[model samples]
Target: MKFARSLAIGVVSALALSAPAMAQDDASSSGPTTNWTGPYIGGSLGYTWQPNTDREKNERIGFDTNNDGNFGDTVSTIGGANAFSPGFCRGFAKGGSAADGCRGDRDGKVGWAVHAGYDMQMGSLVVGGVIEGGRSLVSNSVSGFSTTPAAYVMTRKLDWNAAARLRAGFAVPTGTLIYATGGVAYGKFENAFNTTNTFNTFTESNRKEHDWGWVAGGGVEQKVSDNFSIGVLYKYTRFNPNDYRVTAGQGTPPSLTNPFVITPSGSTTFARTNDRFVTQDVRVTASFRF
Candidate 1:
């Protein structure tokens, strides 16, 4: 009887100790209760206002031919009228200009774009890359004409400022992060010439399309549940201005020899006038934690 009782006691003690040990092992095997950290892909929509500094150009052409004092002024112009219309010199009877103001001045128009990229987290530091693209409208003008006392507007169609960016950030909470980013940028400027009388020439060529700049901002991420999280962020970027040349005579003949003498040595420049931009975006992310 004594032996049986002792055996029974030993069995009960072993089970009691084994129960706690099993529970501890299970908790340890589950690992430290860490949040999800790895590669993530997402998209964001936001408002952006990237402005280039206003630029003006003027030149004097001795129009001894038309002494109304209309010396040739070759100012770079963009959006007033399409320089490609046959009726651009004089407004069209149908009511739309053909000359789309090809080579006069550019109008200062605000524009926007979209973005998508991947992010990774290593402890507190976060790094990633993004691909963003969209369209923009920029303007230029030349008013101080030697003879013609009128302001001309030139509008260039900015196709899109597309680029890839590298990001670095910090994890603030169990499900929150903040970061800064920058990278290489590129885009196309649809170079055309237009005027009030003749919609004569249109030229579409890509030039000096690559640039590098820096972007800085902060954002927050939150976990709504185990598999999904939402985040909101704001960023400011300074983009490099691209420079290229738009040569006319590629379209139709002008009423005169040429509006202005073509410069073989002159350069076309697109400057970032007031390029500080702010972007606000909200994104949804899905994840599986180890």
Candidate 2:
């Protein structure tokens, strides 16, 4: 009886020590848990492109060619009644008629962004909200050519942008997440004007503005570790046009003896039409979860 009792006690002690080791082995074999529920911070490097098909429209130049006090009066010029018949080229204007063929548009630019968000995982589905801020190097311009053989260039530049977005995703067993996100976006824009006309004086207004719009996109992210992930995303962003205005008037020559030679001597105000700004972005992102 004493021997049997000793053997039973030895077996119980061995099992007690081995229990923890067995549990650990089982956990390791089940694979790493990829719970996406938590807060995360991330950054992205991306290319942004503005794909506007139409050239920038100059409402004032198109409608008020004579620069008269009345917009209804149609005054014909050598370049036709419309002052913008020469059309527009992307970026800044290149002097001469051959260079203004509108052959090239602005190229895509590199952009960067930083974001933070929280996610709640419900089984295979995950939902979250995020806030992000970024900067872009995208710029666009429109040019109008007058009979005086001069170019008037108007430019809009994107300074910075921000967004508040909500996301919904499905988590696959392979530690990959596919998500769609959309939200309200805000942006800052700057406006500028350039003219080759030597006989005109220009005044500008509302050169800078803050505007609001929306953004939508989707992405795929793979968890590299329990607390880290890498992903690729595509987004489309758009904002309402901001008011940028310019008024042009006749300028006196260096020699007051020379009469003001330029046509359309009256003051006229110019504005943009169909000027909503839109951009498409493709980015690679790295994120850390807490």
Candidate 3:
């Protein structure tokens, strides 16, 4: 009986110790997945490269040579006549123009952003909403002869952008995620001109306004720690046309010295005005989750 009792006690003790060990083994085999739930806010800095296809499409602004001071003519543009690609000059019905504006090589630039989002985590999927704002280092302008009082100089600039996006990702067992995202985007555009055409040389500028559109992209993100993650993403964005056309005849100061100099003549307005702003962004991202 004593021997039997000792054997039973040893078996019971062995089971008690082994129970914990078995539990541990099961946990290790299953492993822990990265939890991508809740809210997060992060900042990212990256290089952005864009194309100027949209600008090249519509280059002709105006072509009227009839110095009658009437810059109005049949305009061809995306929208209605409110957006003009009209005429300038006097005694001449102008047509045809160059391909692009004076805007220089402004397709690529370095950019940075601040973003925050809330994620809904499922077994293997994550869905979230994020709002972000960043300044794009992309800018370009077109300049040519402004038939104002005298030959004038013109300029335009496109800079900065922002977005609100939705994200959906599939999480792997190793705490890494691959996701796609897209949303509405916003930005600012500005235009200006300087005309010393007449005795009174003057400059005109347009304030940058809100230009809204769409953006889409995808990235691979990995969990670096309990509260931090890192990711690399590629995003593409396209903006609406910010076509700006001006009528010099509307506001022209006649030359006191030369009345026949077509002092009131104007140049063709801008075409699509580089309407399409497309950008490719390669970014490195880091975030902290709460």
Candidate 4:
């Protein structure tokens, strides 16, 4: 009887322990829990393309009263140089030449940039900052003449823009990340002119810094395996108040003009009223994270 009782007790105890082991085995067979968290750094290289848009608007109003006895005609103003002058024998002249002279044209170009950033993992989201710089080739042209001041319009080309960014993203899977970023940017512009009299020259070469703007974009990253991944991103950056100034004065050199000749010429003026710039870029990159 005693032997049987001991054997029964042993069997009961064994069954109790085996039941929890079987339950644990059933739960684990479903799958191991996924662990998603870490700090990562990587580098990327890809073709970057950007479209640059720059614009300028200028207007002037003035009435001159003098005894010059001759009045000028209205001319086509291309390139925004609006003015008129008197001919040798006219009190006032009216024609399409003055009205058409001061109008300007707009053009845009594509360019590239290189970038680097860091991502911090929290739950299922990542946040970081990035800095990038690159070369730009974009420009515009405006060709016409002034009737009041009897001048010509010029060309302006903007090149080289850069930016810094702050980024936030989420981890959709073990290695896939999606993000958005925004920050400040800077750029430079060059204005050139080929007058009816002068050769091509730079009226203004503006290198601007401290230009404030915001940028926002998103990117996707996927891991090919444990340590390597690739991504593609796009960003839009607008410079804050990329304002500039230009003064086109002093056209007739006194040393070149004779006092006896009927110099029907007046002053040539081309000034910057206002200017602003905005740009966008897209690139593909590959990175390796450990």
Name the best candidate (by lDDT): 2
RMSD of 1: 18.5
Error of 3 at 3 (Å): 79
Q: Give model 3's TM-score versus the native structure.
A: 0.65
Off by over 4 Å in 4: 1-110, 142-144, 148-156, 197-210, 240-243, 252-269
Encode model 4's per-residue lDDT on 224-276: one tens digit a residue: 44555556666666654323322233344542332111133332224332334
- Candidate 2 per-residue lDDT, tens place, 1-290, comes to 23323433453444445445544544676543457899999998767887655543322233343556344433344334544445555556676352464334464777899999998999999999999999986877766566556777778888999999999999866566789999999999999988887776788989997899999998877665678877777789999765787776657644322112223554566766546888888777778999
Clashes of 2: 0
Q: Which ten residues in a row have the lowest lDDT in candidate 2?
A: 254-263
**After superposition, which runs of candidate 2 have C-alpha atoms over 4 Å from their true positions?**
1-32, 52-87, 96-103, 253-266
Q: At residue 124, what lDDT does model 1 achieve?
A: 76
By lDDT rank, best first, the candidates go 2, 3, 4, 1
Off-target runs (Cα >4 Å) in candidate 1 are 1-36, 51-118, 134-152, 197-214, 238-290
Winner on lDDT between 1 and 2 is 2
Model 3, stretches more than 4 Å misplaced? 1-33, 54-58, 63-103, 145-155, 194-206, 249-272
TM-scores, one per candidate: 0.48, 0.77, 0.65, 0.55
What lDDT would candidate 2 get against the real structure? 0.70
Positional deviation of residue 221's Cα in model 4 after best superposition, in angstroms = 2.4
